[model samples]
Target: MAHKRDKTPRLGVGGELWITADGRNLGSHARMGLLRAVVEQGSITQAAKAFGISYKAAWDAVDTMNRVAGEPLVERRPGGRGGGSTRLTERGQRLLERYAQVEAVHERFVEMLAREAFDLEQDFSLLKVLNVRTTARNQFLGTVSALRAGAVNDEIELTLPGGMRLVAIVTRGSTEALGLHTRAPVVAMVQAGNVILATGIESMRFSARNQLPGTVLTLTPGSVNTEVLLEVDGGGRLVAVVTQASAEALALAPGLRVTALIKASDVLLAVTV
Candidate 1:
């Protein structure tokens, strides 16, 4: 008897094309469309209408692009009988042509990615992790190693890539809301201010649930506070902010071994949907 074939869906890759000048956004697909419309219609008002944007908004975009490019892309042409018309400058026309070439190449690149990638979902998830930003200074990507449920809170054990583990205490509501489970990927965040630093605590015990020992990588002093960067074991880094006086008291300096103490509750857990 013949067996049935699997019918699982596959993921695709896609991206937007943008041109930048001096780190500033100069043009995009929509902006190029507006330029093309101006070339065909020969009227800013009509171009704006075709581009589905207000006249002023279109002018603003054009002005920004022109300023960033250090050259006028679109210009007004004096008309004899009818109102003045709008047209693209020589540079503007060249820019449009070049953008078309780049867009075609970009389309092919995305198509290749979609066709050649064996697992697009994992690639997309990695992109999402790289794109995450937060005010917290410490961010670690790890997987859930264990979970212990409590009456009102849940104890979560996260294992980092280098074999180091971190424990976090999150409310029961958050545990359910994040859909956290064993072996699930998660991001752990801890603010610099929440981290405490100590030196020569090899034999002493700490009430804090997390004690990460590492060498002082760097110490940055500020007016009132000092930023300490630690190169922890398992190839992870932790940043801690301590007062200038406290930093001096511990003689915190690069190459000195120190421990970062953090409460289990201070670690924030997040997962991508």
Candidate 2:
């Protein structure tokens, strides 16, 4: 008697695709659709209503896209009687066209894959392995230089590119689970907020386990916080976020020397395998 095939890995062709610039999400279907809606409706309020999202959310998304993209995607035009109307900029139209092209190609690719009847389970597993998205702004590929195992948490020293060393504290169970050992290749992730920046206080040693001195490369100030990019001595870039007030207090500026401080516990560890 014939048996029914397993339907564990039921594949689908639908998924959200997005574009990011400088690690900031710049465009997506939802955002592009909002832009299109605004162009059609001629008002942000109307567009938001059509998109079923709040006015503030739509405005904030447009603001972020504009700031991150370094180009205004939408513009407000002053009218005779009314205040203003929303319209897409030339670049915005081009962006929408480009996104449409990419989405078409992506859909075609998925359709082709589906028609081929590929090993659904194996393909999905591989794709899952490749999709390593994390919120941490700082990621480094390194090798475990040293590991000290204890009853509870294990201390690991990772040697990164450009002669930099990062320290991570993990549970002993995690250490064994990830097969973390001396000379094991691993990735270290640290959130930008976790990294503290210190300038002109290098003489005073901090309690933080990791401190790397570097030169400030760029400072991008946002409304609430500022992102400072630093180039480490050997060869690596570190990102640190500080409040506008703190940035001003520290006098963060390009070419200024600063030290990045991170606690070992703040560092997260991951392995490809």
Candidate 3:
């Protein structure tokens, strides 16, 4: 007789759950398990033994969590004849309960993701986008709407999602190496320092190739420089770092209309393979 083949999926999704506060890790499954053990054992020594950790290590973890949480999650009970007991505080119990609820929802999400991730190549591309990190303050995703080739250089025009246009100048060799073509998706990166902020230039001509008009959304002043964020026409934001003196001279303020001037040579283009 022929045997039936196993129908189980070869690919599965799994993840560990963690609780964090202010970007600092505060709790995890192993830590929560230690807390649960303390509740059941009523002794730090016993709990550490059951949790497969040293007693000192367990106490250190509890102390760190308590300090980060701004309150004690575990407390010591006065000893009688045997010894003092360890117990979870009210807040500790609530944390475990909430973690359980969130973990259930997370498990369901992972299940859905695994089911939909049959196309690994496409999903991996999206993961690549999420993992992209750069020092450039302004990164725009768009398509190459036009390209002009010259003897030694090429000018590339990118059309942003909201129909806004950006011009970049790159070497002809770089363009050919990137295989750039019209309608090809690309990322344009411009450092905040490279962007120039201006106001009242409606009829004036500028040497910069890209001029984006927008309203100043925020101004973060540092000791020597001010970082200005502008909300442009296509729901995109551009960040410009200028000298505090220059910012004061320009009278830049939130909600004030301004324009960002970027030279084509200052813009950098990138594409994902």
Candidate 1: pairs in clash: none
Relative to the true structure, how large is the alpha-carbon lDDT of every model? 0.88, 0.86, 0.87
If ranked by lDDT, best first, what sequence of candidates would result? 1, 3, 2
Comparing 1 and 3 on lDDT, the stronger one = 1
Which pairs clash in model 2?
Answer: none
Candidate 2 TM-score, C-alpha based: 0.53
For model 3, how does the per-residue alpha-carbon lDDT over 1-273 read when each residue is reduced to its tens digit?
998878754675677889998888998888888888988999888999998989999999999888888889899998889777888899988987788898887777677656544544331222233456788888888899999999999999999867999999999999989999999998889999999999899989999999999999899999999999999977688999999999999999999999999999999999877
Return the lDDT, model 1, position 35. Answer: 91
Write down the TM-score of every candidate. Answer: 0.55, 0.53, 0.54
- Judge candidate 2 at residue 156 and give its lDDT: 99
Model 2 lDDT tens row, 1-273: 998788665655556679899888897889989988988899889999999999999999889888988989899999878887998899988988899899887776666556443554331222223445788888787899999988899999999877899999999999999999899988888999999998887468788999999999999999999999999988888889999999999999999999999999999998875
Estimate the overall C-alpha local distance difference test score of candidate 1: 0.88
Q: Which residues of candidate 3, in runs, are more than 4 Å off?
A: 1-128
